[model samples]
Target: MSTDTDTPGGDADTAARSLAHWSEAGRAEMEAFYALATEDYRQLALAADWPTVLRAVTHDGWRVLDVACGSGKFPTALDRYTDLSALPEASYDLLDPSTFSIAEARAQLRPPFSAAREFAVTLQELPADAGPYDVVWATHALYALPPAELAQGAEQFVRALRPGGLGFVAQATAQSHYLAFYDAFRAGVRDRTPYTSAEQVADALRAAGGDVRTQTVEYTSGTADRAVAEGFLQRCAFDDAVSLDQMEAAPVLGDYLAGCRDASGAYTFQHEVMLIWL
Candidate 1:
């Protein structure tokens, strides 16, 4: 899960530093990240018939807002998995704190996902008149949102949707590899709070008066290539400074990685993601 939003809390400065670091990450670092992380979007696409789902809310001159749209992987996955030609054209606005990410995402858009507006701001800072969009989504995004700002972010998410409009968020649960591994990373390396979980997202949305429904999708992503696994894990933690050798030797994180490794030395990352509908 990639994050493009800022956090608000006692750790806000630390969070901002992390976001800034990610924004300035080199091209090679970003490419390495997506090498394994692209599966995140692929899995979400396989979870549903996206075209039919989007078509349900499609109307004349309809539009969608993609919150924290990092590299537009969700739309890319949708284009790959569905018949985009069958869906009517719709404007897709992107919102994110990183201009680099917004630009990368914008370049990936195609018909039915015509790139329209770009908002270089955090989700909480979305314009008051932003939208009553036909569809709003944050796929594999929002993990960096701190607990203190979740309520406000959730409210903004719900507020952006038109009545009967679709809202979707795909995130890993507390039990999933993403969340569990991050907790270990904090204990062993960073000493920061864990990334936000799907459970928390659902709770925040419900608390914000959203009618939320959830479904679970389980899978594993593995690699026999140590370099690939290393890149993936580093990106997952958003700290490339910590190498694979370091992670494998770390205390809590080392133990966690051992559990994910096979006798053949392959790494299999288990994922139990929650598909949330609002």
Candidate 2:
């Protein structure tokens, strides 16, 4: 039932396996990049909102489903909220298209739930009778969804949630680093597929009949080395085989990187993310 959540197959596959670029070394490099970049982010406390959202929708224990749960970071961030050990008999359902991600999330997530299940699939592929969850969420994982399917995915979110169930999703805004960089990448590198944006998702969700709310926050990330910046961009584009030199050689990519560089020669990326809820 999934639309385009494959691990970067071919022309038939509309989405790339984004996590493919996130190997151990790449993850380390990204952490280094983030250390230098996210200090000024307004919504630094992104995970703290989960419990608040969970409480607003249902006072009962959570039957939580994390869509595209990558590396279990969202569950890790839950520490800022209530202790997972103290919550009663909660249930966790992990949904993702990556076996690697599902495994990592399972090993890393220490949810307070007494029972947990993992679905190695996308939201669109989830079974019709998976039960209306108390809370269903997709964090930064919707990037791979094709533009045409955004509305269908939004409807899936609504269908997954039970009565009064709450849902939360965080995504990079249209003007954010991810979208902007990809816009430049697609224009200059390859124009095969379009990037899915939070604005588009919000509009589609609202049109699908949900009471959607959005909040934006700013953040910055930087690096002093061009090579480091290039590596980050390559990973973002899910093409590690391509060197930074090649990227710079491309007219559009090279120009985009040039604009992102500052007087100090450090590469800085400014991002605005939207916290969407209903």
Candidate 3:
């Protein structure tokens, strides 16, 4: 695996600082991400939850680790699927870099719905007691990080897992349909990084000394109308670049939005979710 010294938005310090601060712009971006994502993503993500992955693992007490456990959605979903049997009284550590996301996860988790015991911490600094986890899960989080950080994060996951324990890292592939909007939005404005393919991710994990296997899961969503498109756009439009001022000035933005509003008045999207295991 080769490392790119020229970071995505320039220097490492700048990128780190930008990520660390969780500025209003960053929050806006997340909001946009959620908005544009929720409609299509919720179903796709849930569908990716194949029970065979969990059923194959046999551990004494299922201690789980959810890396980049944004809003605790996947963990919560897992709890619902496993129920009182097979996955009773499981422990979960939700690791993420954004305090905003952590806070959201905390707020979202409550009541009988909250079956798995949970905790939240940043990726670089996980709690000392978090480990020896039986099952490690990382879904859609690796795409945000650069190669070096991703490698380091993988090491952390390995360290947290017990011998013979299972670790699954789900990465979005380059062929995902959202790349259309993302690429067009970044064209001529800034250099936006694309997702690493499953093959590349499998190679990287193997190079990093993890026994790995890969699978590609394709998902397609039903067409969404103009209202849905607007909602999606609003949900994912964050930062000054996607702000009202920028949107007003960029003719392409209008064109893109119009294009999203198809002749049938419904927008369609497709995605490839890659599952890697160790």
Q: Candidate 3's C-alpha lDDT?
A: 0.55
lDDT of each: 0.85, 0.70, 0.55
Stretches of candidate 2 exceeding 4 Å from the true structure: 1-14, 19-50, 58-61, 80-89, 113-115
Off by over 4 Å in 3: 1-8, 11-36, 39-52, 55-60, 79-85, 107-130, 193-199, 222-240, 243-261
Off by over 4 Å in 1: 1-9
RMSD of 1: 3.2
Model 2, 1-278: lDDT tens digits are: 22344243343243544644334545765554445433422243453554554556554566888888776666665654345454545678888877777776778666564338888766767878786888787877787786667777788888888877777788888898888888787788765465678898788778877778888877777788877776677657766666778877887878987888888878878888788887
Question: What is the clash count of model 3?
Answer: 6
Against the true structure, whose lDDT is highest?
Answer: 1
Encode model 3's per-residue lDDT on 80-148: one tens digit a residue: 544334433455555666656566665664332233534544454566666887788777655545544
Q: Cα lDDT of model 2 overall?
A: 0.70
Worst 10 residues of 1 by lDDT: 1-10
Task: Provide the lDDT at 7 for model 1.
Answer: 38
Cα shift from native, residue 47, model 3 (Å): 4.8
Per-model TM-score on C-alpha atoms: 0.94, 0.83, 0.71
Measured by TM-score, the strongest candidate is 1
Clashing pairs for model 2 are 37-220, 37-221
